[model samples]
Target: DRGAEMEWISQYPHEKEILLPPLVGFQAINTRVERKTLVVELRPSLNLKSPTIEEVIGKLKSSYLTLLDILKGSLQAEALVGPSEERTELHESKAKAAEELGLQRKAHEETNPRWFNNALNYQEASTAAFAIDAKMATKSILAEMKTSGAYTATFGGYQMHKLGLTGL
Candidate 1:
């Protein structure tokens, strides 16, 4: 573990030089290593004229928006597929039951009054509600991050690996 930590620390200068050119003055203000965790505290380089705070802010905002969009799209797609399939099956069963009973049935009326009034309407409402909630949550998180002077960002390791940055 100590060896790994030493290696990581040793590589920091190179990583900073290549990945954080704009943050040329950044320094490790503090560091701590637990059993499996290594935390290196950093602050803006004192020697730098200006830090790229705007770039960091822009990246954060873009990431939040992209995540929200993906979440909303996934929710909408699930709503469209899940409940609609069940509704179709129920509707068909109702039509068959009505025919067996020799009862007149409306062309577009629902078989079960307790079920959703309409599958399309339910799906649309569910999708819209989830999208709105996700948007609100994203807004709240971004606002909090903006207000907080200390911002912590996490990157997906899998994504980095895919991009061939794992060796870095």
Candidate 2:
């Protein structure tokens, strides 16, 4: 039953090929209908280097613009078809969807940069803390060896210090 429903929705002429904007560092992996809603999954594409924050923000803005354009076009098409109860309902739904999308875009623009900066700051602080801890651990080990009276011993008339550090 669910499969049949999904197939029907997908077969709708106007619903075919939802035009998505070009996205940087991301690609659409899959799309399916869950209940009455369409769910699309986007995965980050592998790259030798990551994109800058500004690039990410720009992509987001472009995608938002594309969505608005699609919604506007749909509204215009509906207008050309003349007035009917079904058309009226569809128009209202489209308007509400557009409004909701606009709100989401605004929220993302306001918060995403701050969230990214906080995450970067936290990573830097954690790395510094770990480095300091490692240094202290190494120093403590050296101090313990000194306190235990471990001294360089001579072998075959050669001082242990003469060997220095070596790797096999």
Give all candidates' CA lDDT scores: 0.43, 0.46
RMSD of 1: 27.4
Instruction: Extract clashing residue pairs from model 2.
Output: none
The estimated TM-scores of all candidates read: 0.22, 0.25
Model 1 steric clash pairs = 25-45
The residue ranges of model 1 lying beyond 4 angstroms of the native Cα positions read: 1-115, 152-168
**Which lDDT tens digits does candidate 2 get at residues 25-53?**
56788999999999998765545466665
Tell me how far the alpha carbon of residue 144 in candidate 1 is from the true structure, in angstroms, after superposition: 0.5
Question: What TM-score does candidate 2 reach?
Answer: 0.25
Total residue pair clashes for candidate 2: 0
**Where does candidate 2 stray beyond 4 Å?**
1-53, 56-87, 113-168
Candidate 2 CA-lDDT value: 0.46
Q: Candidate 2 deviates by what RMSD?
A: 29.4
